[model samples]
Target: MTFLAVARLGRYTAAAEVLGLNHSTVSRRIAMLDASMGGRTLVRTAGGWEITDLGRRAMAAAESIEASLRALGEQAGGDPVQGMVRVAAPEAFTSAFLVPAVARLHRAHPGLAVELLAATQRVRQNRSGVDLEIVVGRPQVHRAYATPVCDYSLRLYATADYLARAGEPRTVDELAQHPLIYYVESSLQVDDLDRAVQRLPASPPSIRSTSVFAHVEATAAGAGIGVLPDFLAEHDQRLVAVLPDDYAHPLSYWAVVRDGPRSTAVAATLNALDEHVRSVGVG
Candidate 1:
């Protein structure tokens, strides 16, 4: 189990947190597993831990055992939706949708715990640690299921003061004159966002950040015209849409889960998230 946790999470500290054990204990167990297996299973890398061929075989066997145990528990009527459900998602959606969904789930299942990893990256092909992932575009995974959660729009926004100081651009060509605030091009991972940025007219002077929240704040503070999600920017009274109808990028949020029988906790979490997204339509 310790080996499985380590392999899934890729970091000793993260595995320890999930397993509710100290860092030393987790390390010792991995060492023992290596000794018993007669080969190195995992190696530390710049990105994280990389699993070896031997480790892949071990993981496959361990997963089968785990599935059998879960089936046995269900057969004995011991299936209860209570435990940890880890999720990886974008920061904006985590605050706008997931936090409230988890809160509601907690009220019904007090024994349930959730760990949310705020990230803005593509869905990893090897989804080891997280039970669920919410991404900006439709994900293509070999062994996973994806469902569209909601559609949102990204449009040009600016503060009234900024617009007054630098006249608003009436056409896409004219946008070149004003400064823009958006994600740093080099750090961006999602293709949908990249395409959106590519479609926009080039603006020389701009503020780039890795965070959408920062984009909203800078635009509100009269930094520059920001391409921001409507769900996030529409609520801020300080921001005014620049070209509501003329310029908009439509995007969908998708929920992804591993392709197999889900644990009770995972099922509950996914259901709760779906319900919340439906209740509050984004687009």
Candidate 2:
């Protein structure tokens, strides 16, 4: 944890602060670890204290050890499928498909309890005490164990009232005239913008919220048309599909881990989440 903390935090001082130790103590710990391995674990440069190649390998090995430890715990506990799991996901998704999905998982695994850290904020597995994450974007994050769960197929949705008041849109061009609910897209570092916001051809400021979940709520409140993830919008009684088949913003849901499941509860929770996603299918 020490080596990786410094590596990830990118500052010996910051890492030292996090560990509640002096800077020299942190340096000594790194130096000692390096002495044991006979190679430098960190490199000093203009950027900051960066993780050397050796350090990265060490971190991976450390994570592998964590996985082994969990395996050992499962073997020792005798009951490997009982515990609480904390998952971080988008708010609207949590309020919609995720709740039903979680209920389904509870039905399947009676011993497992789920805690959702739902919001627009992206919480890292290592930084946050989260077992799994159901992220809708940037599925490919190196140095983490990830499994594919579902696709957040986003489409334009609107309340029937909003559509009735404001004329229906048949074409993408026609949508420009309507008061569309727009929001900030800052959950993950999306590389492919063209494929992300498929419902919107280009950015034009529809409503301007810092959260997609907020956008969904606003859409349900008859704010206007909104391009929302199907998982987050499917169960919204007030909101209905406007043009699901016409456009698609399919983002993958990843079951990612920073260091893998630490406790039996976390493991069970992850298992329950997997089961739920399978049963729900983002319909």
Q: Pick by lDDT: which candidate is best?
A: 1
Looking at model 2, residue 40 earns an lDDT score of 94
Measured against the true structure, the TM-scores of the candidates, in listed sequence, are 0.80, 0.64
Which one wins on TM-score?
Answer: 1
In candidate 1, what are the lDDT values of residues 1-283, reduced to their tens digit? 7777777666787778878999999989988888988999898876467678888888787778777877887799774667678899999999999999999998988878899999888987764568788999998876677888899988999999999999988887788888889999999999999888677788878889999899998999898899999999998999999978789899999888764325578878888988998899754
lDDT of 2 at 231: 63
